[model samples]
Target: MSQNGPKMNEFEASTATEIRMDASRSTSVFLTIYSDFASAEKVWRRFEEYADCYAFQSFDFLDVWYRNIGHRSGVEMQLVVAWGAAAKPLMILPLGIETSKLGRKLVWLGNEVNDYNAPILAPNFGDCVAEGDFSRLWSDILDTLPAHDYVELMRQPKMVGHQINPFTELGLKLNASGTHMTQMSEDFDTYYDEKRTSKAKRQFRSRRKQLNEIGETKYVHPNKVEDIHASIDNLVALKSEALKAIGAPDFLAQPGYLDFYKELSAQSLNEGIGHVSHLEVGGEYAAGNWGLVFKGRFYYLLASYNGPKFGRYAPGLQALVELMRWASEKKATLFDFTIGDEGYKAEWCEIHEDLYDHIQARSLRGVVAQSLTNGFLLAKRTIKQNPKLWALFTKLRAKLANHRDFG
Candidate 1:
């Protein structure tokens, strides 16, 4: 085991510190704390190479997101990295410390925008950690983290790259809803036939026929940089309007949200990971989708369509069909509708990937905070899962919005 200070990295302007601890008589692990982003970039770049990493955990994606969005939003980076004996990097827990009404809390970095969150573990490490070793590791992490009321980790997958997520092994409550996904076939025809029911296929065909009647419709995955930017802009604008119409807060309206996407899009252009697809009617963008392709899976992230103009034709559904065909052609094995259980998602996806939320209280105040937070989440989840309750809630929300808009 080795110990180092911030002086090792010249770019370390913030407090750069490292600690080494023995997990067992024979096994030792070292933890490094990075307060500055630049100091961690080199290590994160190497850690990303392990096949266990997902696109959302990539340095390129999170770096852009953190710089543009998280940094300004009271998020303080506390990236904890662990390395095994011989300095073999094992995992990177990208965390941030923030102060809220409850108190100082530690959370997973990119928790706001990231659909799937888990420690970026090295290959084969998740299954190798013994129960005792994990307990020691968790202790080490808690000791290293700055003073906080609780540790809250959300949207964690049960497995990453076929290995059980170590976080789940610690025991956590299930998140509100499971993410939806579709397993793709080798060919688009086979996938469409297998995933979509006979009635669904008929409806899709009818929708496509209706779309064609509007104009010369085209489904396009834009590779050109300019087109990508334009497509993202269209998606944000359309989505904002849709949210307004539904009386929901427009996420894109939030500070730095649009910039985060634009930055991520630009940075991911050469990597072929960030993809922007669009359905155009009469040469005008009718629907757009921004997604990521990593390790043979396509993550459907954000999507929007000109609902008022194209709702009758179901242009969004048409765009999704074309996108699935594109994914099949690209040899993608799965199409994950990242973190929602909308009825439309169920129509296309049969697989449900459960996510978990973890909350560990450290003190007396933390216990009270945790209980309150947990109760609120449970109530919110109950409402969300009940169709009648959720519909009534939305109706009320819409009426409130109407009052605000008209008054």
Candidate 2:
């Protein structure tokens, strides 16, 4: 192992403990662990082409992540590209490595912005590859890891190929991550016709009519600079209102974070992966979501609102419906509602992906550290899950966060 590079752990192919027995025998694998995105261009682009098929997996997002977070955080990125003899890439996992108590640990990159993390594989691989491809891939990863004592897989959404069941079956402790999802059909009419109850359809129609009566309600899906900036403003405003409604600190209230989002918007737009969808009533913007559109899919990244004026019409829902319809028309395969399984998302989406917050601790010190971390998370989840305890827990967290000056 080079001084700056990760240590290598040699293991035999058949006897490797990490090798998943479920994958097919014919699948050949190639692995490249990167210290940074700039150095991992060849691998990043290879898998990203497959990732771009999903709207949430835009190139600009990966770029923003490289610029704002990873490089500054001293985090090492790992690029694993599993391919066949033809050298065509099959699965790509863009992972970040962090030093823990035991040794170095691996996780998905950009956890701060991206709601979900999963391997990027060509759909065609799904057909030709054997059943145990995932097992073989992990076996290779485990064998290659030298200095790492733990592998932490974070926020892998459900329904994606990397199912948690198999990992757990493989003896890795699994944590079920919290997230939300929404599904969109070919068009609004078709969606209503096939999925919605008559009452729900009528209610939405009534709301639309009411919104129209209030003033000219226009749906804006902006992909340019001027419109994107406007959408950012709305997103900030809505985020503030939403946070206040729940008596929580506004995330975008922090100048640094807001600036980061602004920079991301500019970069995403310039890179042709930016998306800003809004519902403007009369001359005022009611609500909007600023995310990214990769390939044809739409990622509902962020949003804001004009509380009192557009609250009745559910401007947020309107924007989502409009954007989803547009994406469908554009031949998008999915509309990601993004992280957190909120009530609204349950009503809108049919798909539910499971993501795990994983931590691996091999050494004694690592075990102690893992216990502390996992204990805190477990306590937090307990409080958050109970409605009666949530308010008190929130206040406590807020007070601690304020004292810590979390940014």
Measured by TM-score, the strongest candidate is 1
TM-score of each: 0.92, 0.75
Who wins the lDDT comparison? 1
Error of 2 at 256 (Å): 5.8
Task: Give Cα distance to truth, residue 177, candidate 1, Å.
Answer: 1.4
lDDT of 1 by residue, 1-407 (tens): 24454333433323333443443545556677788678888888877876587788878778888887888878888888776655666788888988888888889888888898888888868544664467667876787678899888888889888777888667688788889998888988977887778987898788877777778889977767777788888999998988888899887888888877776676555774677789999788999888888889999998889877888877888888899899889899999999977888877887898899999898787898899989987998898888999999999999988898999
Candidate 2 global CA lDDT score = 0.62
Show model 2 residue runs off by greater than 4 Å.
Answer: 1-28, 50-59, 83-86, 99-104, 122-150, 158-183, 197-210, 244-250, 253-271, 384-407
| Candidate 1: segments with Cα more than 4 A from true spot | 1-24
Candidate 2 lands at a TM-score of 0.75
RMSD of each: 2.7, 6.3
